[model samples]
Target: MYFLTSTLNLSVIMFLASLSIPTSGLDCYSCSVCRQPFSKKTTDTMTGCTVCSISQTWVDGKRVTTTRGCDKSCSPADLRIKGNGLVKTCCKTDLCNGNTNLRWFKSVVLFSGLIVFKLTHI
Candidate 1:
């Protein structure tokens, strides 16, 4: 009886532990698809596309830096533009920054859970 009880407790603990882990290992921010400070290339020149690159600088007593990039993947800009309608913008259509790997993992986990539940119930 003790062995059976211990096995059941262990199973429950393992199940709860699985839930604690984030099924989605997606870095939504700072991803190439999410932080896309530029537009998709249509031509060789990347015209009208904005480009942004972050760099750290030491200023006076503080370390400060600015996000610099092109206004439209081609045009220069000093700050991040809001709703500028640039092509290939990250996080515009998808919640994740084009993280296909994370998406796949999430889907697999969801489906697997459903299958397990169905099997147990039926």
Candidate 2:
């Protein structure tokens, strides 16, 4: 009986752990099709489209860094503050997240949780 109970308890723990979101492995929507879906009455990128605006630091109409892929670890943000700076702009549209990977927030939450746990345990 004890062995069975122990196994059940461990199984529950493992299942719950799998459900927890990880700090790393943040991904978001991507593909140029998001920019202008069905441009000429034809499908491209095979993904739904939405408009999103990015206001990163730009020079000469060029962005510093760019990457795109489906972010399996993406969580929708209602009003995500870009950064603490002199100027910041936030815009949301259907496809805004297609080319962006906003994963830092997850890391922040994880770190905060760890800090709180250590403080309470100590």
Each prediction's whole-model lDDT (CA): 0.34, 0.37
Clash pairs (backbone) in predicted model 2: 27-71, 28-71, 50-94, 50-95, 51-94, 51-95, 52-96
The segments of candidate 2 whose C-alpha lies over 4 angstroms from its true place after superposition are: 21-23, 28-122
The number of clashing residue pairs in each candidate reads 9, 7
Residues 42-118, candidate 1: write the lDDT tens digits.
11121222222222233443323322222222321223244222222222111232232323444544665675575
Worst 10 residues of 2 by lDDT: 84-93
User: Candidate 1: what lDDT?
Assistant: 0.34
The residue-level lDDT of candidate 2 at 97 comes to 40
Worst 10 residues of 1 by lDDT: 41-50
Question: Each model's TM-score?
Answer: 0.23, 0.23
Off by over 4 Å in 1: 1-13, 21-33, 36-99, 115-122
